[model samples]
Target: MARTVVPYSSLVANGSLAQPAGTTIDQSNGMYIAAARPELTILRVANTNGTDRVVTIKAGDNPPALAGGQGDLAVTVAATSGVQFIGPFESGRFIQADGTIEIDFAASFAGTITAFRVPRGT
Candidate 1:
C-alpha cells in the first residue's frame, strides 16, 4: 500500500500577508506543526513584533479534497488585522492548476486559503 503525508507548513507576514519579499515555509521561521493526525494538525504561531501579522498555508497542486462542495481553502485577514482560525475549506474552489494562487489585498481585504480538510463522505 502507498502512504501519503500532507505537506504541513505555515507562513507569517508583517503589514500584510502579501509582500514584495513574501514569506517562506521552513524550520528557520517561527511557524511549525507541533501536533498532527490523519485528519488534522495543530499549528503554533508566535508574534515576534507588534505589527499584526497574517499567516497562511498554500497547498500546491493535488491538495486533499474536501468531502463536499464546501469550496476551496482560502484565508482572509482584514487590513491591518490578523486571523487565528483560517480554514476547513474545500481544495477545489480556489483556482485551476495552470498558475500560482494569488491573494490581492488591493482588491479585497479577504485572502485566499487552502481548505483545511475535506468533510467526511466526499
Candidate 2:
C-alpha cells in the first residue's frame, strides 16, 4: 500500500499561526512528508492510546550502502496524552529517493500527527 502524505504547516515569523487538527495516524500504510527543506521540517505526534507506541522514521536509501546502515530513528510516545516532536532531519540521513521522508508506526497508534516547517531565515 502507498504511504499517506502529511502536509506541512508553515510557521509565521512575527504573527500567530493557527493550530491544525492534524491527520489521524495511519498505522497500516505508514506516512511520508514531501520534504522540500528537510532541515526545517518537524513532525509532531500526539498519542492518546493506553499503551506506549513506537514511531520509526525510515532512513534514506540514497547511497545504498548507507541505507539502513545508520538504522532508522525510533521514538516512543508515552501512553495517554503523550506528545512528541521529531525532526529537523538531516537530508543525508532521512530524505528518500522520491524527495520525501517516510514514517511508520510499530503498532497501532491512537491520536493525530502533524508536520510543521519553519520559514527560511526565521
Model 1: ten consecutive residues of lowest lDDT:
25-34
User: Model 2: how far is 10 from its true place, Å?
Assistant: 0.5
Give candidate 2's whole-model lDDT: 0.85
**Candidate 1 local lDDT, residue 80:** 38
Q: Estimate each model's TM-score.
A: 0.28, 0.91
Candidate 2, pairs of clashing residues: none
For model 2, what is the alpha-carbon lDDT of residue 95?
76
Tell me the tens digit of each residue's lDDT in model 2 across 37-115.
6789988999989999999998887663244468789999999999999888887788777788889996768888999
Report lDDT (Cα) of residue 105, candidate 1. 21
lDDT values for all models: 0.31, 0.85
* Candidate 1, 1-122: lDDT as tens digits: 21112234433323223312212222222222212222433222222333544544444244432332443333334343343444332334332244233222222223222213222332
